[model samples]
Target: MRRSRKGQPVTEIFKQLLCFFLHGTSRHLVFFDTLAKDAGYAAVIESESTSMLSSHSVKRFFRSFRWPRIYLFRHLLQRMFLWRLKLEAPDVVILGIDTMVMDNDEAKVRHGVRPTYKRVKGF
Candidate 1:
């Protein structure tokens, strides 16, 4: 299990693997399996995996944790991403924001799907 800077367990790093299969987006399982096998396709930055990552194990684990903490989790993710942006403020020439909506028609995806900026009274 991986951990955040605050030493909190980051289970979603694995759920990312779950979302690949359980969500029925694309041929996620085939893609995952193919990539897991072909060591030559691995990048220099990628350390070798000891064993293949199992989607079923992930599904079982996800059932235990996928509830009630999205508010906290999303904030934690945003804070980490913002911190990275501050540290690596690249040159303006190649800087851009790319918002990707994955393989779904998401017309009414969620309540906060639209971009909004609001000031809160307290930190």
Candidate 2:
């Protein structure tokens, strides 16, 4: 038996996730509205059928929710999965490390803009 009685169902974050993956269209308020309407969010929720968010809200959500966390998670997962599968390989010819001076930044960078060093305190 399905449990009942709640103030309202939570707004569907899962749909937003699926919407991004399956459709691959980034959301504007209009886009989300159209998607929700086509996917029958209009029929399901009488109140919020107009726009899933304001354009400002959509921008905020994209910056806040979608990109920062999920994108990082996906990259980490992809790297780990590739490593596990041994599918990752260095694209360039390999070199043996002799010693010192990573040359993390090349000469093209400004002289004042030295690479950030993890300083220990008081040498």
Candidate 3:
């Protein structure tokens, strides 16, 4: 599913995103600025140029994808997941997700803030 469009390939962008989540300090785009400066981390992406993509470039790349393309990517990911499961062939497949409560009580003006079960103000 490689596109002929110029610039970074889809796999490279996906690798950058994976690296971002694995090494990022915070769950924000600002972390990309720090990641871009790390030579050791840049090598992990295995790209021709040992340079990390900027947050702006990543944002632009995400914005460029339409709903249909995004759905197609999701389907591709699902297929990959199924293929990996087949290869692993585990006896018991237990799926779990961890959820965290973000506290935003310090904010002066809360737009979409709500009170969680913990009685904290956050999404």
Candidate 4:
């Protein structure tokens, strides 16, 4: 007998996430309504059904997710970057880690303006 409550396959869910990141609109929405309406996302996922990508489902996906998965994904991204550097034989590979900062629109950004080691004078 089928399970009491079946959910969408993991692969399908991941594909949806990937599509959203690649083609979603700039405007921020809790449920990513703009992302769901993306033409590229629709084609890649092989479905144009809004019900399949409902706001509740999207919110549930984020709510039920674990941090360890995100850590693992970050490691994978770094590994890919290193692999590409090796293949291309770059003279130097400078890795930059960025920290998220909350500030007003007047903030100025310049080359080497905000290094990881140096902290901003004013908060």
Of the two candidates 1 and 2, the one with more favorable TM-score, higher being better, is: 1
lDDT, each prediction: 0.49, 0.50, 0.78, 0.61
lDDT of 1 by residue, 27-69 (tens): 6445655545656533322424433444454444445564456
Clashes of 2: 0
Lowest summed lDDT window (length 10), candidate 1: 114-123
TM-scores vs. true structure, each candidate: 0.37, 0.31, 0.63, 0.50
Residues 3-93 of candidate 3 have per-residue lDDT tens digits of: 5565577778888888678865679987777778877667666654444777887788778889999999899999999999999999999
What does candidate 4 score on TM? 0.50
Rank order (by lDDT, best first): 3, 4, 2, 1
Per-residue alpha-carbon lDDT of candidate 2 for residues 12-123, written as tens digits (9 for 90 to 100): 4434545445665664355754555453654444345544433444454456555667888799998897785576565654559775434434345454644444531211
Report the alpha-carbon TM-score of model 2 versus the true structure. 0.31
- lDDT tens digits, residues 27-98, model 4? 343445655666675766796555346556667766775688778878999999889888999787687988
Model 2: how far is 61 from its true place, Å? 1.7
Measured by TM-score, the strongest candidate is: 3
Q: Please report the TM-score between candidate 1 and the true structure.
A: 0.37
Which stretches of candidate 2 lie above 4 Å from their native place? 1-11, 24-29, 38-56, 65-71, 83-123
